[model samples]
Target: QRGECCSIDHSAKLAIPIMVAKSDGAINQLCQPGKKRRRAITRGQDEESQKASSSRRVTHSSVRSDGGEESFKWILSKRQFTDDATKQVIDGRHCIWSRRRQRIGEFDEFWTKSGKSWEDLTTVKDPETVISNFIAQQISVHATNANSNACRTAVGMLFRIQGFHEERINGFALKQIMKKTSCNYKEEEKGRTNLQVRNPSEAHTGKS
Candidate 1:
């Protein structure tokens, strides 16, 4: 009877006799008058319920998402440092930040010794502070050397890189840098005009 039931596809509807015959063992055991059969049925139901509950708990607690769970497990397994090592790294000052400062200082000292055009150290004494100020100065100098309009454009680019998409540098600050750099606005304008005049015919042809 069990073999016949196993052979039949579940999708195909079977007659009552066939269903009864297939499940005869389970039905007889369950319906027997003795308390043993009753106990067996109850135990089977309890076991099934426990299995379902266990599965639910596991699924609920486990990290889900196709590749995410596997990736997380991989990362966790690859970590070499124990809890103590992690605590030491976190609590100690001899880490990445200190190493970065040392590297920057070495570079700055080398440039100073070589008499190369380095950032002014008189204004910013701290290594970290000097790093930021130096970058700002370099950018300002580049902007000034490029052209009169370059300063404003450079400031816009700086703001975008710093994650401020909408903010712009004030006109006064830009004017101050331009003045300090001694970039001659009038000379640049005159040069542009001279170039335009020299190639007026070529410019007109290209435009058309």
Candidate 2:
């Protein structure tokens, strides 16, 4: 009777270790290859569970969730300066000069032809004041069309004088013109096309 009880107690201890081993095996299959080798071994393990866990592990490593790299590339490719803004940078000085010259010419014609001496006009200390006053009066007649076109032309001339690439200048101008005229549709279509052209891989991934 004592021998029978001893045999049963030994079997009970071995059964506990077997259950522990099974639990370790279940956890091991979820771990990577290097990690799996470190886990405890087990008997009576479920083959299906091991296969499922292995598949999941492979999927996790193979699939990328973050689109950050593609997004950054897209943004960089889409970055561009508008024509008006570029024109402002390039031709601002010339535009100012032209406006001042036109004002001086008008002043000379008006005062000199009316019997005032050229010396008297030249003696005026503040040319800016005279130009400002004259511009205020002309603002009503030709402010919109004249100012905009003159500024654009000045910008174009500046770009040419500075030896900027014509293609780049035209592209910048085109973007500005489209933005100004289309407002919604052109911008949206441009954004879509830019994304398509820049990120063909991303589009393919989405389609699949």
Cα shift from native, residue 55, model 1 (Å): 67
Candidate 2: lDDT over CA atoms?
Answer: 0.47
Report backbone clashes per prediction. 0, 0
Considering every candidate listed, which one attains the maximal lDDT?
2
Q: What is the Cα-based TM-score of model 2? A: 0.20
Using all chains and alpha carbons, the TM-scores for the candidates as numbered come to: 0.19, 0.20
Q: Give one digit per residue, the lDDT tens place, for model 2 in 1-208.
A: 9999999999999999999999899778666675555453332255667988999975543332112122212222333545565445435555465443333344344444557663443344443333333334434454443443343333333234334455644554444543453444457567667777889777656542
Report residue 15 deviation for candidate 2 (angstroms).
99
Q: What is the lDDT of residue 34 in candidate 2?
A: 54
- Which lDDT values do the candidates have, in the order given? 0.45, 0.47
lDDT of 1 at 161: 27
Tell me, what's the RMSD of every candidate? 24.4, 24.6
The pairs that clash in candidate 2 are none
lDDT per residue for candidate 1 within 32-142, as digits (tens), equals 767887798999999999999999965643422222223222222335545565445324534442333233333344335556432242222233332333434555555
